[model samples]
Target chain A: MIRKWSIALLGWGAILGLLAPMLHTIWVSFSPDSFLTPPTNVWSVKWYLAYFGDRRWIHATSQSLLIAGMAALLAVAASAPAAWSLGKLTVARQRLLSILLLLPALIPPAALGFGLLPLVYFTGLWGTSLGLVLVHATVGLPIAFLIIRTCLPAKLGELEAAAAGLGANRWEVLRRVTLPLLTPVLLAAGIAVFVLSLNESLVSIFLATPTNETLPAVIWPQLRYSPSPMVAVASCVTALLGMIGMLIVIGILGYQRGRLIAKNTTAINS
Target chain B: MQRISSWLPVFASVALVCGVVMAPLLLLLRVSLYEPATGRGFYTPGTFTFANYAIFADSHVLGIAGFTVLCGVAVATMVLAIAYPLGLFLCSLPPRAQSIAVGLILVPKTAGLLAMLFGLQRWLPRGMLATIIAEVYLVLPYSVIVIYIQLLNLDPTLRDAARGLGASPWQVFRRVTLPLSLPGIRLAFQFGLMWGLGAFLGPLFLGGPSETTLAVELHRQAFEYGRWPLAATEAVGLLIVVSIAAWGVPTVAQLRKVAHS
Candidate 1:
């Protein structure tokens, strides 16, 4: 009895530990206090308002959104054809490409980010949204690939075959059959990639300059030099974005199907 | 001709992706071979030198590398230990409750890591312990998920058979459940160690000055000092360390089978 009970206890304890910081941050964000303390009594959204009111904050948030949006879209665009192509390759060749696709995730992100830094710099694309978008889209490719490939139902092959039998040409079958089934998954992959890109921090830090600070970039310096309650608000905004992304992804895949497909996908902790 | 035509686009896409990823590593090697930056710019831009690689000889740089490995081992160990009980506890739950528990884990997980770290600093003293704790938060969700999935895949009859043979609960867990979930445990450790080796934002914002990992210092050298050569040197060092530790990635080998199947 004690042993089973102890297992339950430890499990819940881990959950509490996992949640405490986020829960506490949420509590602190609600504080009306001018500084960085949790509320004693009254809670307010003044900090959130203050955050929204600031031009720099708005601009940075917009930049983060722009980078994530563009990156996610790029990943989606590249992956469909690439994943389709992957299906055509020899098994060994497909495995090699799969590993290659996921290589960015496997590497030390610092190594990954810094390697891109020189590429960005020498290309004179430093502090450019396009540069960051390219980097993020590259990083996001695997997750996008994984989701799309997994979600590419086997029925797709059957449907394509039927279309071919009916005399639909290659492009015609792809246009009519492969694309229709793919539309929903591509949409979900885009959202997944978007969330991953927005939440990405380490690479953003190295690549972002004053001219192109994403929200994480904005939050980075404040963390070291000038900490504040409004920063908490900014953090909350990002937390909120992550929350919405999760709900949207869940909504798209539907709970049961998402769970089923996600079995192979794992958590993309980017 | 038809076969060749179909193969072309697939090869093109794969080549593009491989080039993007591999180009950086190759670039890092090329850049690291350049002279250390002078007043002119990030580097001399035309000169060759190996002086930057000499940083690995410095005790301070070596310490940072050692600390990174230590942190990785520690985080991976703790995450794996926690995952076992969490996995079983999750199994004991009803279906609806299981999903809720998963949501609890997933919410904090997908919630921006930086945001969680910021909140963590306020909640705990902002330093190494806090950084490790935040990493635990960073990794624990997936570890639980991995372990739970592995546990779910177990043949319940095997465990029951052990229990029916008069084995104690602990004995059954030790002999049957633990051995069976070995793959999950290994995977969870791999996940933890991979992030731990490359642990960046945790030590960056949450950790103390002494806790600087190569990633943090790479940022400092490159951006703070405009020392691109040095940053590239450290990037190469980081890769070497990761590849060394990554030998244990049975997951990659596992994925190879899954990809083809």
Candidate 2:
């Protein structure tokens, strides 16, 4: 009974702790006064109007979406071949290569971003939207690889071998056998990359100037100065966007899981 | 298996992508050697000097790096401490309850880190304590996810047999469970440390002036000061430190794995 109570407490503590930040942001969003002042008034969306109506916020939001969308596409495209190679091929030094590819994910973005600033600035690509997209792609690559790699079929090698054993060539096997199995994971990976790229601030900070500022960069100024409730409004919107992206990914995963079960059942019957 | 060159095209493309991605970072090493007067002319063939590195070594950069590693260690220790008991508790829960529990832990993680700062900043006392609290909270879910997976992957029969032989719960945990789970624990610890070190926006917003982490310092150097060389040197130094830690962690983890095996 004591153990059960403790576990229950742990679960509740985690949930409450997580909720604390979200709730506070929501509360402050509607507050009549700024920092350290007691909030009055029932819930209001004035800050939402201030954030949505602001030209800067609108521009930042659109830039964020464009950068995030392009980054996701490029990252997923870059990683798909690597992930497929990792899942389908058996070769020497594979593990080392995979680890090397994963280094960007392991390193701190601040470190990487700082390193990139000089090089990027010199290349005439600094402060450009496309440069920001490339940086985002680099950051998102390992995550994209990991997510797609996970959902790869366990029997991939067997299927490839069978296809080869029959009269089918490599291209035929790839087009027919492998691509179908890999599509869901690719979508999931894209979604994860999209969400992460969208919320990204650190590298974007290095890559962005005032004219090219991402939402987080713009929102950051609000935090340092007289923080308007609009900061909270932006934070809430950002959180909502991430959650929506995650839900879509999870929904796809659920569908993939169902198909996996059906595949297993069919195999058992055969 | 027959050696297949069929995948070479794919491998080469991946390598090319990684190479392009790495170009800017690789340039940092070159910039670190360039003269400070060559500011925006970073690519110009200038006399190489150690002035940038010397500057970084003199500034609070060294102090920032020390604090970063220290905080990372502290947070990693805290996470392992919390995760072990919680992982055990998770194992004891029913499957449905376990899923729900895991989901609740992960929800905050997916909500993006901005929510994490905004949420915790509201109720908590600010500065290092709040920063630590947020870092611990952010890292906990990941640790739990890793540990829970480890626990589930473990052979439960050993615990069952130990209990069957009249061993107490404490003995089973101490002798069988804990000893067997060292590899997983090591993995969880490494992840926690890495996450703590990489944590940017958390330290950027939540940290006090006294707790200036290397990550935040890197941001200041580049954005605020436009001290590219200083920032690049510091970033490179941080990479080296983290690389050593990253490299050392897996070796230790593998040794533990071998011992356990």
Candidate 3:
């Protein structure tokens, strides 16, 4: 009984600890006057208005969305085929290949960010959306690879073989069968990649130029120098984007679950 | 023809991985060996030396590396301590409650690190304590999720058998549950350790001057000083430490499996 109570307390404590920062951000986002004074009942969307009114903030937000969207697409493009191929390999080879693919993610972001600098400089991609997209996509690759690799059914090889025996060409098998089965996993992987790219700050901070400043890069300096309610507002907006991405993930997962249940029921009835 | 087509993807992916991922890392390693040039030149083109690594022999730089490792170990331990119980509790909850719990955890993870750090700065006292707290906060969700999944996958029969034998809950946890969950715990610890080692924002916002980590120094050298060689050396050193920790867990597990067999 005591152990159970302690576990419950710890659980709530952990949740509250996770939430306090977000709640504070929300609080300050509303209470713009609290920038000078202690937080109070006085609330307004003045900071949100301020965030929108500023042209730089608007530019940063759009730039972030563009980079994240492009990165997500590129990440899926890069990882899907790799993951599909990896899933077909022997377990030993799959493990080795997976580790190699994930090695970039394991490298400290600081190192990866600095390492890419020379390339970015040489390629004249410094401070460009294209440069950021390439870097973000590389970093987002591991997550997409892991998701797709796991989602690819182990029995897929047999299914592919069966399809091939039925005289379906490779392209025909992929388009008519494999791709359809992978759509949910692809959507989930895309959402994960988008959220990761959207939340990414360290690499963005290193690579951001004035014209390509991301939302986090724009807000980072403000946190250090100004420390205002406006930072809180921007934080809230970033969190909202992440939450929306996660909601899409949850919806996809729930839909997949419903389909599995329906399929199982139909199997039983038939 | 079909065999060739299948091998084509393998060839393409390997080439892409090598070009985008491995090539830049090689560039970093090469740049680290290049001697610093006079004036604004970051490194001489032809010259190679260990001078960049020699710079790390300085007490100041060594101190930063030492402190960073200490913080990483501390954060990993602390996160495990907090998140293990939290995971247990989460597993005990109904599916709906677990989903809500997980969503709350994902908020900080998916939200911007700077944004979350900014919020933490307003509430916590600035220094080492706050840095640890924030680092653990950043990784706690991951640890919990890993452990919770492990718990869910655990065979209930073992726990029931232990209970049926008049074993106390504590005994069941210590003997049956903990041993079973060790792999997940170790993986979580590795993740927490890696996050702490690579930590930048937490140390930047929450920590004082004394808490300046190797990552902070690497950023300073690369950006503020334009000393790419020195920064690359530091980055390589960090990479070595992180790679060891990241790969060490699986290797140990592999060895353990061998021993069992």
Candidate 4:
């Protein structure tokens, strides 16, 4: 009993540590005073108001959202078919291909940023949202692939074969069977990719120009040079979006798991 | 003919991955070898030299690499220590509790690194300690998630049988749980180590001048000092180090599995 209590305490402590930064940011954003000094008055939304009043911050936020949205869509599109292919391949081939796909994530972001600079310049995509989207999609592909692949039913091939035996053509089988089954996982993967791309700073810092600064890029200079409650407000906004994204992902995953459990129970009963 | 069509998506994705991902990396490697010209742009064309790599002999560069590696190892060790117990704790919880715990832990991870670092800078003192603390916070969720999944997938019968055989709870954990989770632990350690080695923001925001890491130095060299070849060299060096650490752990784990089998 004592051991269990201590373990629970440890878990709570870890959670508190994880939440400290986010909570502090939210607190300071409303404190209506300097971070260095305590608030003498009631909480206010002055900092949040300040964040919205700044056109640069608004531009950064919209840019980040647009880029992240495009990246997520691209990652899902690229990885879904690849994941389907991987599921059909031999185990050895699948492992090799998966690793190859994951290579973008394994390397240091700085290397990728430095390496892509010349390519981006030569392709005339430097400082463009399209370039960042493409890079972010590549970075997000691994996670998206993993999620989609995991959600793919192990008996997908068998199901396809069965559908074929029922006189369904390939396109019919895919459209009527495979695509429907994949929608939930695809949504989950898309959300995960969005969160990853939104939070990605290292690569964005290299790729972002003054005209296309991302939210994190905007905050980076502020954090480095000038610290203020405005930074806290920006942090709060990013954190809020991230948490909402994660919560939605969790809900989708839970629903998927529930359906799987129900199917398994029915299979056992029959 | 139908079979050929089915392979089209696969081929297209492979082509996309090669064009978008592999090509740029190849570019990075080529650019690293080119000679850098001062007062010219990021790189000078039509020249190659070993002189760029020779700059690693500078004690400052060596010091930064050594410090970065040391910090990586330190962060990896600390994260594993903290995450191991937390992983076990999370695994022991009810499903609802486990999910809640995981969601809370993932906030720091999903929240932008700069945002977290900003908050941390205000909360913690600047130095090596602050960098480590922030990095640990950044990486703890990953380690815990990996280990927690490992624990969840473990065969309950193994623990039950061990207990039935008169093994104490501690012994069961040591002899069964720990050994079984070793692969997950190893993976977490590698990830933590790599994140630490690639740490730019942690040291940038939370660290003092003296705590300058290899990543930060690479950035400074390339952008601040206009030394592209030197920065590329450092980037390549970092890549090699991280690749070894990333690949090394898994290879060792596979070897151990083979030996055990």
Candidate 5:
């Protein structure tokens, strides 16, 4: 019907509008000129080469990877146990606790950055990787919690109870039963946490120092005023890492869903 | 013993929340009451005062809070408007098509906020318009997902039954679909508003000085001016306002549910 077509038209129009900036970023990053401008008469990898040729950009990239990795590990460690225990709660309790865990995300992250700026200085971790890692973990924990919690099987208690009834002790149940079941969920949460921390800008603006500066911190200043292709190149690399992270998430989630469907169909057939 | 043992694992999450999040927040609250340094440190380390909050009483500071709230509301409304059609359309598609639609839509958000904003800063014009547009873009993905998930949960049988009963499509939507998805739409609006309040990157990266929200002001005070006490004041103020605004959210949605039924 005409209505359906019009609605589709509107939806697609909105999607295109939303995508405009990212597309522009990609286009601008490839600008053949040393300085960035629109109406790209040509395309070149000069910026990409420039990024590779520069020591600071490469150092920033490695620093970002190291920080993101450590943060993700810490986040998943905290998130997995929390998610499993939350799944054991009654629905009402579970909902309330999840919201409590999510409170860090709901508030302005500027608040966290402001708070951490002084705390880190006091703790003697100011501008250190240790400081950024701890802060990133705190910020990424809510998302990591949500990811693992959602991906967890609904019958978590039933499964754990079944294991315990079969003579597994608490530690045994956790080690032998709970962790295996949680592997994929933990993986998903870990990657999600890593990607978020990698592209993180807000807290990094406050925390990053000369030695510990991440790609976003490096990209931040260069983005101001008249940006060059080098800035675009850095942005493009960060953007690409984000897309790669999304693909990994989709693959893991899809595989999990596919397995669940297969199990359901097999049960029906048998 | 069993109940106590069962609670042991939950303690890790509780510890992380309390230790990493709440402790620093509490510390910030304490720091807000400190005497700001005139000559030496981030603040006078131990001296306590209410002077930072006194600055908040000034009309200039109050204007920033008011402007921030207005921006949040504007971004929320605009994001919801754009998101509704996409949510409806995505939910209408078949499973594979639905996934494709979602995947396509996530491209901007998945590219990450910093990169996307860098692009937006270049493409969009400056000032409040650019800030709003970028915030809307930053928020649209989440809003659409909220609405789509809500709409997907509706019973298609109700729509078919409405058509069978001789209601027009518009009537069916107004009578059935609209009523059912009102909760989702409300949730989307609230979610957008919460995120808009937290719209630090968009405004920071793209907006002019006149577009200074409370979040940006907090950043300016802390980093730019080295006024930790003033920044902590802005942070605490932002938290109180968001909590107060959010209190009315569930009630409005609940009232809508009653009215529709």
Candidate 6:
């Protein structure tokens, strides 16, 4: 009972710990003060208005969305085939290829960002949306690939074989059987890609041109030089968006697991 | 024939992406030696120099590396200490309690480091203590998640059998559950150490000059100093330390597994 009480307290403390930052952020967001001093008087949305009214924030936000959207789509598209081939295909260098694909993820992200900085600079892609998209996608690829690998069924092999026996061509099998099965993983990967790209300050800051500044990039200098309540507001918004994205991914995964379990039960009953 | 042709386009595009990804890494290794005196930038082919590696011999930089490793080890230890009790509590609880506990633990992870850094910067006591607190906060959730997964997957029959043999709950846990969870413990430590080693944004916010880590040092070199070769050396050194820690964890785990078997 003592152990249980302590565990419960820890659990509650963790919840409180998670909320404290967000609550502090929200408080700071509405404070009339420029600095993130604890509010003395009536809390106002003055900082929120400043944030929303600011042209730089607006432009940075749009650029962030544009880059993140493209990164998500491109990352998922590129990784899908690689993951499919790895998961379903029997190849001579399967293990080696899988390791190769995961190599980007295994390497320190800081190292990867440094490495890419030179390439972006020399290629004249530093300030371009395309450059940002490709860099984000590169960082996001291993994650997308890993998510797809775990979520795809090992029984895909037998399922494809069965579909082929039933006179389904390869394309037809992929379209009818594989794509539907992959929908949840696709959504999960998409959410992950979007969130990762959205929160990518290091890569974006490294490659940011004045024209292509991301939300985090805009907030980073402010974080260093002039950490006003505005930075708090931006941080809160980013954190909220990240939490929502994570929830969407987790929810889809849970629903998919439930569906799989139900299907298994029905199969057993039949 | 049309299907195969259409598929070829998609495959080709992916191949192109692979090429694009590979280029940067190759360029980083090559450009680390370039003196930057030439009008050319990172991609320009240049002669290699040991100068970049030589600057890393600075005692200050080496001290930062030592401090970062120490912080990582400290965080890893704290995370394991925190996670084990939480993991035990989770496994012992009813299903609803377990879900609630896990959800609470995971909430911080989804919030990202930025928000925590923002809050910590303003609220927490400054210096190495704050950095350590934040590092522990950042890694503890991950540690719990990893250990919880392992504990949840633990074979219940062994515990039941131990109880049937008249062993107390504590003994059963110490003998059975603790040993079973060691792999998960090692994994948590690995992840905690990796995260703490690369702790840039957190330290950037909470840390003082005294607490400057390798990651912070690398950032300072690159952006603040504009010394690309020096930055590359610092980055390479950070990678070496992190890689050794990463490589060490699994080797130790495997050895433990072998010994136990």
- The count of backbone overlaps in candidate 2 is 1
Candidate that would win on DockQ = 5
- For every model in order, the TM-score on chain A comes to 0.89, 0.88, 0.90, 0.92, 0.90, 0.89
Question: Candidate 5: where is the Cα deviation over 4 Å?
Answer: A163-177, A260-270, B253-261
Residue B188, model 4: lDDT of 84
Off by over 4 Å in 1: A1-9, A84-88, A255-270, B1-16, B154-172, B248-261
TM (B chain), model 2: 0.86
- lDDT computed for candidate 3: 0.80
Docking class of 1: medium
Clashing pairs in 3: none
Off by over 4 Å in 6: A87-99, A153-155, A260-270, B1-22, B36-45, B90-104, B250-254, B257-261
Identify the leading candidate in terms of TM-score. Answer: 4
Candidate 6 residue lDDT tens string, B1-261: 965654452363255346555666566556667664455442224566767777667888888988889888888888888888778777877876666567556655544546666777778866898888877877777678789889999999999999999999889989998888888888888878887787776677778898888878877877776777777777777777887888877655678789899
Off by more than 4 A, model 2:
A32-41, A87-92, A163-169, A261-270, B1-13, B38-45, B56-59, B250-261
After best superposition, candidate 6 residue A9: deviation in angstroms? 1.1
Candidate 6 local distance difference test against the native: 0.74
Model 5 lDDT tens row, B1-261? 998877776676777777667877888899899988889777887798887898778998998898789888999999999888778888878887787678778766755666678788877777999899888888889889889989999999999999999999889999999989988889899888888887787778778988888999998888779888888988999877777667766655578688899
Q: Which ranges of candidate 3 are over 4 A from the true structure?
A: A1-6, A34-38, A153-167, A258-270, B1-4, B10-17, B247-261
Tell me the spans in candidate 4 whose CA falls farther than 4 Å from its real position.
A34-40, A260-270, B1-7, B250-261
Chain A agreement with the truth for model 5, given as TM-score = 0.90
Best by lDDT: 4
- What residue pairs clash in candidate 1, if any at all? none
lDDT of 3 at A4: 68
Model 2: residue A50 alpha-carbon error in angstroms: 2.7
Candidates' C-alpha lDDT = 0.80, 0.74, 0.80, 0.82, 0.81, 0.74
For candidate 1 chain A, which ten residues in a row score worst on lDDT? A261-270
